[model samples]
Target: MNKENREVVRPDGTTIHYTVTGPADGPVMALVHGWGCDRRDFDAITGFLPRHLRVLAVDLAEHGDSRSTRDVWTMEEFARDVAAVLEAESVGSCVVIGHSLGGAVAVETGRLLPGVVTRIVALDALHYLSLFPAQDECAADALLHPFREDFAGAMRGMVEAGSPPGTDPALVDAYIEKMSAVRQPAGLSALEGLVSWDMDAALRETTQPIVVFAVRAIITQEAIDRYGDRVRIETIELGSHHFHVESPEATAALLAAEMSA
Candidate 1:
């Protein structure tokens, strides 16, 4: 499959960057990366996908090559960034797959385009109780205080939290380095947007079938018990929160199976 790099100008004049592969007329699958990550995270996964499925891996504004001057950093705004790519391509229907923070963006995409989005797939996303569950104003502020005070330290802590036992220390360090370098205040602001987001409200509004592929080590039973009835929760022991990167072929297979089903 030939991969084509492209950009779409949003209504707000932000240039959203993305990569497309496989047949243009094939069924569309839009892959959204987690915070501090870009579309390249899905490069290996896209390579493993069936030739007939068109894959659009997007770099949300201020992430990767996508540039944005917009002030808003909410999940809904991020969803619109993805929506702009779909609209530019004239995509009729697509399965929106998001990783970590991207998972929240996927839900918002479903809500924004109920008729266009058929399904939502969350890769190690939406199951973190501390992050997903709605937080009170004070609680949210407290959780964000560390990041506000020391962004680099908070990012390192985040990488450590996602990494399980036996995970390579080098890999953890690499992730921390990459994530910590995210463009200026946008990275910090995006983190604030995610931690403060109302997951309950987003879930309430999005009616699409959501499948969560959670990392076994990090996912809490409490999270499953709470959202299992609302979303399909499947735990996988293949990798950590960044499982798709650790096990691309397996992750691609899961996505392919869902897309086919």
Candidate 2:
């Protein structure tokens, strides 16, 4: 299916970019990308999906082609942005799938949209690592200061640090293209908010069928265990921190399967 671009005007006056793919009459599956990435992050997964599923992939504000007006970004703002996109398309209900930072936003979307989003798939994000409990001030300072240096340097460092080992050069290049375009100040500020926000309570409160694809690295078994039945945790063993690019087809298939279920 051909994808169409849309410009959604948020209440805050920011213009958000969203793309719709697949047949119009099928079940709608909304995809949200993680921090510093755009809607195209799902390219590897979207193409192979069944024609009966409509895909809506969005570039969260200030991340992809979407414009940003705020001096600072928060998880609440990100969640509202997703809601605005759905409202723009007049979507009444959908299966929401989000990756990394997008997962947190998806949870908030379920909360904001109420009965509209019946299912959620959080790929490789259950808990925010930076928010993990620390012993002392030094540890907290270390985590917070990791990106406080030069902005460009921080971005490059992030690319190196988060990418999966032995990742394809083409995939790496594509990821860099999406992430490098993020404005330094805006990206850093957004990261700060992401690090601080905790979504455990929200996840626990969600009554919708939620599946959390827990990445091998960063997330622990204990965290997944705590989620239990409310959160169906799955592991993508092929990739590291960024598994979407490494196993896009598998991710898409799982998404399609879950949405169908």
Candidate 3:
């Protein structure tokens, strides 16, 4: 695929890097990678997508090729980074898709650009921590403790938790290594932002339809029932947490189906 590497600067002086493919006049679709991941994660996914659909894969501040000098690392801030990208590209309307943490960012992106973003798609996102009720102070602290103390060890535990019975050991190891290598303060701060995000509130303010393609083995009935009225939850047997990365063709089919609908 022929892609143009691009950069956009937000109001906070954060420089977001992104890759664009397909015709500028083509219907738009934005891809946001998960936490500790970059735009390249969607490289295969984009190839499997509809050829005429213009795709923008972004590297959020301090992640991938993006850089930032800002202190606030909230999902809203991340959405603003994406908003800047869209603004720079002069995209009038687009569907925003995000994976894991990017899911939260996608929701906020819809909230931030309700007029510009038509819908939100979450890949293995918005079911667990993102949708779960906000953690109390003590609970939040406990969750942060492990990462603050031993980031690598905690990253391993998280990767394992997201995997199901038959996932490959080598795949899990690869995820652990990649995630553990995320930049220091930004990685931790982003986690903090997610832990503190209020999904319910965001949903209340967001009018765009949201759909989640969550791992069937991991997503709970409680999650489906709790937000079913507001968001669509579709379970899949596709690998593990990083299912989109593992199964791009099928993922692209699903996404294309959604967009066509």
Alpha-carbon RMSD to native, per candidate: 1.0, 2.7, 1.1
Model 1 scores a C-alpha lDDT of 0.91
Q: Scored by Cα lDDT, where does model 3 land?
A: 0.91
lDDT of 3 by residue, 66-114 (tens): 9988899999999998998999999999999999999999999999998
Q: What TM-score do all the candidates reach, one by one?
A: 0.98, 0.87, 0.97
Quote the positional error of residue 65 for candidate 3 in Å: 0.6
Better of 1 and 2 by TM-score: 1
In model 3, which regions exceed 4 Å deviation? 130-132
Candidate 1, residue 171: lDDT: 83
Candidate 2 CA-lDDT value: 0.76
Q: In model 1, what are the clashing residue pairs, if there are any?
A: none
Candidate 1 C-alpha lDDT tens digits along 1-261: 899999998866589999999898999999999999999999999989999999999999999999988888988899999999999999999999999999999999999999999999999999987776667788788878998899899989999999999887888888899998899678888877887788888898888999999988998889988999889999898877788988899999999999998
Candidate 2 structure quality by residue, lDDT tens digits, 1-261 = 688988888755578999888887778889999888888888778887887788889888887788877765867689888998888778888988888888878887898787799998888775544542221456545655756755556566666666656767676666666676777667877776666665666766677888888766656666756665567887767575568767778777888789878
Off by over 4 Å in 2: 131-141, 169-178, 228-230
Which residue pairs in candidate 2 have backbone atoms (N, alpha carbon, C) closer than 3 angstroms, thus clashing?
none
User: Cα deviation in Å at residue 233, candidate 3?
Assistant: 0.3
